[model samples]
Target: MTISGEFLAFISLALVAVIGGVLLLNLTKVVHMVVGLVFTFIAIAGIYILLSAEFLAVVQILIYSGAITIIMLFGIMLTRHNDEESDSKGGGWKKVLLFLGVLAFGAAFYIGIYNLDFGTEPAALHEKNTEQLGVALYSDFVIPFELMSVLLLVALVGAIVLSRNDGEKEGDKE
Candidate 1:
């Protein structure tokens, strides 16, 4: 029944992550949603550091907080979206239904996890985790890794093409 600093850190980080997710879901503006996503990413990275996986923590910050967030911003900037608010008359019922659904889902999730037994032994995975991860990724998962890179390149090309088309259409109208 002792409270440790690690436990406090974890609780705070988890709360921040949850708040960020809620903000992301409830935000009215796209840019504000992106800010919430960044908050969630950074909080997750902090949790990773607390878990003794420094390499994973750095990767989380770099890949998610840095690269992915920047990519999202670029995507947002590339696409045009109407910012006008829509009429929401009679939306109260829909909100009530959604809230009830979420409650049911949460209850189910809690029940499922209440008596879960995942074994008692701790994994000896803290040492040289980065090196081990690199070996596994390069040797066992090389093809998938390369394929993912190719997929990303294709997405980038598609975005450029779509934006160019939009520009040409606007020019034609002028």
Candidate 2:
């Protein structure tokens, strides 16, 4: 029996997601982890496209892969002073726990996949593009959206406050 196009696409996407996740976890350096995160986001976008959510796929790539990842990279670069020695102490029981957690997650996912009977009927697609998303954001989800904006603003202010070198400069003035 031949696999359907949709099934093949889903399998490929799943493989990519798993591999990216593994790479992200195994990497010791912050930059490599960030690159793996980008790959994971791309794989998730591919999955979204396979599910016919084109707008969501585009938003995933634009917001998560582009904006969020860049912000994280900048944050890491600003915060880390000695990047070479930062990851040298990563070893011991943490690795064992991580391996166990991954094994458990894989077993659970396999069991769920084998047991579940996904209906073959196709879902009716919607045409809610960017304009519709904006309308919904300002209408139904207005409060939550505004709250998120406030949260991000607060985080930015906090980062600036924490990274200020006022005390360090005062010590040098003596």
Candidate 3:
């Protein structure tokens, strides 16, 4: 039997998620880990699109993949004294536990999916969804959005404060 459009989209999203998760697990280097995270974010955006939340998908790509990942890479570069020495070692029972954890998670996830009763009717697409989302954000969700902005500002200020060389008085160092 031929798969429906929705089923194909779901399968594609699942494949992306699996690939991203595997990349995240196998990569030892910081940069590679970040790249895996980007893949994961992209996969999540794809899932959001499958759910018909296009605005959320775009925001997920923009914020998590674009902004946060760049910020993380910058932080890593700024903080590391020796890039070559910073790479973490790979070995031991940790890998075994990680594998087991992933196995258990997959089992549980499959069981949950098997049990859930999704409504038979599919949702109708709203032509003005973007506009409705904007209205909702500015009117109903304004306070939470403002709070998140303040939180981000605080985090940026904290990062700056932490990275500053406060003890490096120029005359004293010489």
Clashes of each: 0, 0, 0
Q: How close is candidate 3 to the true structure, as a TM-score?
A: 0.74
Give the Cα error of residue 71 in candidate 1, in Å: 2.8
Model 1 ranges off by over 4 Å = 1-3, 166-174
Clashing pairs for model 2 are none
TM-score against truth, every candidate? 0.80, 0.73, 0.74
lDDT of 1 by residue, 56-99 (tens): 89999999999999989988988798877788887899889878
Worst 10-residue lDDT window for candidate 1 reads 162-171
Q: What's model 2's overall lDDT? A: 0.85
Candidate 2: 10-residue stretch with minimal lDDT: 80-89
Ranking by TM-score: 1, 3, 2
Error of 3 at 68 (Å): 2.3
Say which candidate scores most in TM-score: 1
Q: Candidate 2: where are CA atoms >4 Å away?
A: 81-100, 110-123, 129-132, 167-174
